[model samples]
Target: MAPLSDPAPRLARAAEAPALAALVERAYAPWVAVIGRRPAPMQDDYTARISAGQTWVVAVDGALAGAAVIEERPDCLWLDNVAVDPAHHGGGLGRALLRFVGREALRRGLPQVGLITNEKMARNIALYQRLGFEEVERREEHGFRRVEFRIAAAHLAG
Candidate 1:
């Protein structure tokens, strides 16, 4: 895995709403394909997330390979969405996105960060565990079984 800065895929603050929407849709297609649904709902939500300063993208050598969005509530930072192009899955971009979000959580004085993954997505749930998150709860939401996780407050950097 290359360090995020090794060759440095261009990273920037994406304030343009449409471009962010396009990135999110493309990055999410493969996963949505699994669910057999149009990505419209997610695309709308993600565009709003970006408009609200809750997201970012990383271009692998100038082409968008992944994106992550965070929503900070009073008590916890939420990883609302995290996606990597299926074609670029094992190149460390996904881990880099998670690590970046962790740093942001610590910086904003958030004691913890939380996320939910589809219950069927066992690999994703395992990945979150590997990144230091633990399952805190589970519930059915929007017709999808969901698993929720939270990082410990003490582990946050400050």
Candidate 2:
């Protein structure tokens, strides 16, 4: 793809619930198997409720290749989830979507953007680090160790 750092207008709205769920499934399935349970909404029942912040997507040739869920709760800007189509993994879509989050956070003057990922997923953690997120907290839940990472607004802008 050409430079994905540039925002593509209204591209995410085209990704309706079903397609976004499918992409989420492909992205989360391996984690489900490794962690012994689905992380967020499972297939057939997944709803894309990314209203509080924004949903950003990456497309190639008009196809839904990846997506991200950014929610701004009363507390902080939350990067709830990010997933690229399994078929399009490692193609810069994930990084592009993450850049979108940083830009959005900087745009809104939010203090930071945070998210949780399974601790066992080392590669995901590394990716988050490369994207400017720092591990801020950790907790064990339902037999899974979850690590929370936050990227400061200054970091996003820098």
What CA root-mean-square deviation does each model show from the true structure? 3.5, 2.9
lDDT of 2 by residue, 74-102 (tens): 65678777788888876666776776776
Q: Any idea what lDDT model 1 has?
A: 0.69
Assess each prediction's global lDDT (C-alpha) against the native. 0.69, 0.71
The reply for model 1, stretches above 4 Å from the true place, is 1-16, 36-41, 153-158
Highest lDDT against the true fold, candidate:
2
Best TM-score among the predictions, by candidate number? 2
lDDT of 1 by residue, 67-102 (tens): 777888898888887777666767777776776777
Off by over 4 Å in 2: 1-11, 41-53
C-alpha TM-scores of all predictions = 0.78, 0.81
Q: How many backbone collisions does model 2 have?
A: 0
What 10-residue stretch in candidate 1 is worst by lDDT?
A: 5-14
